[model samples]
Target: FEEINDELIYKKDFDIDTIKYAILSKLNPKYLGLSPEVIILEL
Candidate 1:
């Protein structure tokens, strides 16, 4: 996201929890007007 410079990663594993958290972080924030595009910076 260019607007806020959003960043995320999965260091060891790409499990459900990691994906869930990433989605929630982007979608559940109140300040943001719309859901941010989820990004995986590294694996």
Candidate 2:
């Protein structure tokens, strides 16, 4: 993949862990096998 023009989309000024936890909590039970830490790392 080639790099396209990058843009600042959404901006967050909150804590990283709090944001990750919030996202993880909203996930479906089927995704329980995926570690929340892994998800954050892959983000």
Candidate 3:
């Protein structure tokens, strides 16, 4: 993800949706059950 951030910063515009999808797709299943409060705090 750091690599992605560095590459995106080099480019003009960053696609936030792509980053969100990438994070969601790669997150561990154990983390998928986080409560809304935890999720908000993590974000």
Of the candidates shown, which would achieve the greatest TM-score relative to the real structure? 2
* lDDT top scorer: 2
lDDT of 1 at 12: 55
Kindly list the per-residue Cα lDDT of model 1 for residues 1-43, writing each as its tens digit.
2234465543554586678576776664775555455555655
| Superposed model 1: Cα runs more than 4 Å off | 1-13, 29-43
For model 2, residues 1-43, the per-residue Cα lDDT tens digits are 2334774455456688877778877978686775546345535
- Better model by TM-score, 1 or 2? 2
Candidate 2 runs further than 4 Å off: 1-12, 37-43
RMSD of 3: 6.8
How accurate locally is residue 29 in candidate 3, as Cα lDDT from 0 to 100?
Answer: 67
TM-score of 1: 0.33
Better of 1 and 3 by lDDT: 1
Which 10-residue window of candidate 3 scores lowest in summed lDDT? 34-43
Better model by lDDT: candidate 1 vs candidate 2: 2
In candidate 3, stretches whose alpha carbon ends up further than 4 angstroms from where it belongs are 1-9, 34-43
